[model samples]
Target: MFHIAICDDSEYDLQEISSALQGLRHLGICFDETWYQSGRALIDDIAEGEKSYHLLILDMLMDSINGIETAKAIRTYDVSMPILIVTSTVQYALAGYQVNAWRYLTKPVDPGELVREAAAVLKSQEKSDETCYVVQSNGTVIRRVPLADILYFESSLHTITLHTMREDIEFRGAIRDIDEQLTPLGFFRIHKSFVVNLSHVRRLSSRSLVMVNGDELDISRARIQQLRHALMDEAEREHISSHRMRS
Candidate 1:
């Protein structure tokens, strides 16, 4: 089940958001909601408590602590949690990016817009559940390798090799099929024969990717732009996740 936290100083605004979330239940979305009056309260709970949430809706303005500052504090402990900033002015919208907020809503928030953003976050989290790739090794031993452990997939002559943190495993599969399963989970196809996990990319050059495992993979000339975009996106995500672990 998805857990959501809403923090707003204004009780009226809080009620409005709560009502909108209730309406989502009819559309088959299930979630647990928690409300906080100040940003500090919510931040403290996350940092000090065991409860984990999927999303956070923060008010951009508050007397004690503003949403942006709260989001920054949260980033110090929990980076991947999706944050949606609610503001009455557009000026704070750009500031939201500093905290790596997933999205922002201008007040008064449209219920439909909020629902759309929430739905997108839920879908992304669901995709994250695809963390393992099942393959038959040597045509007999079945294995389920955690996707995070895999550095990259090398394809040649219709035989695919999974280069992981521990060892390499060879299997028969189509590169296209591997791409279909992993691309959505942050793996990038830098060349027709190589698909690298963005999280495992340690360095990048004009024509190659240096993986964390010390393997250098060639980047296709045609996929340079796509690879760059994927790297930037992955860096932001990794920044958040690492902070969470450190905190």
Candidate 2:
């Protein structure tokens, strides 16, 4: 799914954009749209998100903030989002370069043009379905567990405990040893003794990373980037595909 955010002071203009988006739906585009009245409001929403906004449709002029400035600010957090600037005049089209505008549409933007641009954006966003990791335990009682089901792994005195959806699996191995095998599956060693699944992460704090199961794992400074990428929210398209397969 494409997460679209539109900021326009004039409700009429917002509706026009919304209608064009609905046109995409008429053509069978399944996505969601978020509306904002002004650039300031859009900035505030982006501030609260742990992940980057994917697409933004902005009106060039607002009383409080300019669309170009707003896009620049959003780019401060993430540079890859596709930004579409809407205006009656192309006066600020050149200014849009500051924010890496994907396209600039004039007032009375054609529904076909808007729909076409958005379709291209969505196509670019298409990613492979969610990936699952088949985790296997050692010894006579070997079991398989999906990576998404595991909350976090804890390293003990020469043994690792996998806190999972249904049960805890104990294996004779060191945290470092298990981490080597889990990294390819999106697991990160946040702390010296903890290997966590990014999908199950509830939140990441200065000292710990929280899991959906309410368990907290220690976070080491060295692993912050890896943890952030892992804990970031999954895309809607990805979320759907991830649930379709059981590992």
Candidate 3:
């Protein structure tokens, strides 16, 4: 199921688009929709990072800001998300082209076109590479481990232990410093003492992150979003693949 958003000021237009989008359900598509009355509201939502909609269906001419300008703001953070511009006529179509939009959808949209465009964008999200992380130990012997077999990372008074599904390694260092190195590798620092392997994460929330090994660790409130993207989403898919392959 692809998460989607239909943003338009006209209630009548939103209703029509919503109904048309629901029809995609028949074609094995499920949508998580949000109705934005204006492009300004949608842009603010993106800034807060709360409402993340994968596919955006925007009307070209809005009351406050136009869809073209609104898309530029969203592109600042999400350049890859597919944008489908719904315009009244082709005259306004060229304006949306500047944003590098996925498709120009004719206003009073066609059901067939909507379904096809949504499918194409959603299919592109799946990743082929499995992700892997190399965590270096700051000890007498320089050691690094594959992130997949890692259950979690624990920090004591002055040492951090890399807990794996098989074994645990103890190192004398700050977990904070190690976190910087693992940032690109998909390890999220859930707690001050723990930096979790997103791939090994099974269940997670604002309070805690549960590893595949069933070990529970506290989650920092500020890091909840990053942790969510890592574990529950495809954000961790490639990392898991690389680590598992190396093991």
Q: lDDT values of the candidates?
A: 0.84, 0.74, 0.74
Model 1 TM-score (2 dp): 0.54
lDDT of 3 by residue, 1-247 (tens): 3467788889999999888887678878665778898988988877654555557899998887888989999887556567989999899888887888887988779988887887777665433112333333321112324455677779999977889887776767788876887766767788889987776777766698678888988888887887666665545476677899999
What lDDT score goes with residue 6 in model 3? Answer: 85
| TM-score of each model, in listed order | 0.54, 0.55, 0.55
lDDT of 1 by residue, 49-113 (tens): 34456678889998889999899998876667788889999998999999999879999989988
Worst 10 residues of 2 by lDDT: 133-142
How does model 2 fare in lDDT?
A: 0.74
In order of listing, the candidates' clash counts read: 0, 1, 5
For candidate 3, what is the TM-score? 0.55
lDDT winner among the candidates?
1
Cα RMSD, each candidate: 13.9, 15.2, 14.7
